[model samples]
Target: MKVTITSIELKGPFKFFALSYRAMHILRQLKATNCLAMKKRGYWIKHYTMTLWKSEQDLKKFAMSGAHLAAMKASKSLAKEIRTITYEADSLPDWPTAEIMLKKAHVIHY
Candidate 1:
C-alpha cells in the first residue's frame, strides 16, 4: 500500500471555511478514486490527512485532478505552512503516528 500524510496550517481562521468547501469536493472524489482508507484530524487553523491507497498511482490520480487540484493551487495563498510525506506502507497510520512522521517530512512556508 501507499500512504500519504499531509498537514496544513491556515494563515487565519477564516481560511478554514474556504478550505472546507474545497475539502468537501475532495472527500467525494476520494471515494471514487479507490482510496483504501483515509482519516482527517485537527481543527480551526490546523488540518491533517492520512490516506491509504493500493498504489502511488491511485493516490496521484486523486490528488492531481478535480477539487484537490484546485485546493493545491490555493495552498500557497490559503495556508501559513504545509507539510507532506509519502511512502510505501503496509497500512495507514493513526493520527499520532502520522503526526510523528510529519515532523521530519517536507514543509512549505507560505
Candidate 2:
C-alpha cells in the first residue's frame, strides 16, 4: 500500500475553519483505500491527514482531480505552511506509528 501523510498550518482561525470543513468534505469523498484526519494538539490551526492507496498513480489521480484539486489551489494563500510525506507500507499503520513516520519522513514544504 502507498501511504501519504500531510500536515497544514492555516493563516488564521477563519482560514482554519474554512479549510477544515473542506478537508472533512474531501475525506468523505476520497477514493483512497483508507484515510484519516486529525487535529494537532495545542494548535487550532494545525491539522493532519493520512491516506493509503493501492498505488501512487491512484493517489495522484484522486489528488489531482475534483474537490481535492480545488482545495489545493484555494489553500495556496490561506496556508502558512504545508508538508507531506509519501511512502510504501505493507499495511495501514496505527496513528502513533503514522506520526512517527511523518517525523522521520522527508517533507515537502509549501
- Top of the candidates by lDDT: 1
The TM-score values for the models, in the order shown, are: 0.95, 0.75
Question: What would the per-residue lDDT of candidate 2 be over residues 54-108, giving only the tens digit for each residue?
Answer: 7788788888877788898888767887777888885666768767777776554
Among residues 3 or more apart in sequence or in different chains, the pairs in candidate 1 whose N, CA or C atoms overlap within 3 Å are none
User: Each model's RMSD to truth, in Å?
Assistant: 0.9, 3.5
User: Worst 10-residue stretch by lDDT in candidate 2?
Assistant: 33-42
Clashes of 1: 0
Highest TM-score, which number?
1
Cα lDDT listed for each candidate = 0.90, 0.70
